[model samples]
Target: MENKFRRIMRTEIHKGKRVHLFHDRLVTPTGKEVEWELIMHPGASAVIPIDEDGKIVMVRQYRNASDDYVLEIPAGVFDKPDEDPLVCAKRELEEEIGYTSEDVTFLYKFYSSIGICDEVIHIFVAKNLVLSEQNLDDDEFVTIERYTLDELVDMIFDGRLSDNKTISAIMTYKVSLERA
Candidate 1:
């Protein structure tokens, strides 16, 4: 079978430190041509840091995009283009929550927003955590919190836990535990 779609051209519309915006022209299978705008991201990793007592570590920070303080799992963009996701997850856990883990398991990965952006977020569950000093970025202001798995699930159902990565990681971990 012939290829159904082709990218006629892709032009960079804007470039930022963390993202790039592109305008793409493509021909569809039906011979229809369209121009689409897409945002390219460097990808990121998040971790659900579970301490020895089974409480999950989270962070509260002010998000400029949302204009509110939001609760989320510790996450960050890849330190380098070829950095491993697991390494990024561990780094973020320590930076945001002041905990390092010896047992870090990949939970899942997904596109945070597929319609307009190509940002893939890898989530991991970090166990056997050891407390350490947080190494937050100079501009970062985060407050750490701990909650049981059940408490997090309740927050998700009650609309309190609205961050996508946090919600996904917690729910995924809960379901995986049930299956085990």
Candidate 2:
């Protein structure tokens, strides 16, 4: 069987540093014309920086999309096409939580909103952290928060931790620890 959907043409409606909006014209299996609205992003990275004592570093910031301040692991988009995900992860951790790690490990990567957006989030675990000055972006309004691994697990179960990338990283770490 042939692929039903075929992109006949596309036009970029808008573009930004992190995302782009596009209008795509396509044809269905039956040769019906259709148009789709799509959002594209350079993707991002999130870090669940864990100190030597097993405390996970997080940040509380107001997300306009959520209309409230939410606690989440430090994360940022990869602005440069050639930027390493680990570097972005490290930068985010230091910028948002004021901590640098001697060892950063890639945990997992996943898409954020797969239906309409091509945003992939790379997650990392940073260990052996060194306290440092925060170099947050001018637009970033964030406060640092730390929670023990056990406390974070409880937060996940109680739904207090709602950010997608944060949840994924914590859950991955939890499972990996259990297996280890």
lDDT of 2 at 53: 73
Residue 16 C-alpha lDDT in model 2: 80
| TM-score: model 1 vs. ground truth | 0.96
Judged by lDDT, which candidate is best? 1
In candidate 2, position 58 carries an lDDT of: 86
- Measured by TM-score, the strongest candidate is 1
Off by over 4 Å in 2: none
lDDT of 2 by residue, 28-77 (tens): 98888999989988878898887777788789998988998998999999
Global lDDT of each candidate: 0.91, 0.87
Candidate 2 matches the true fold with a TM-score of 0.92
**CA shift at 25, candidate 1, in angstroms?**
0.8
lDDT of 1: 0.91
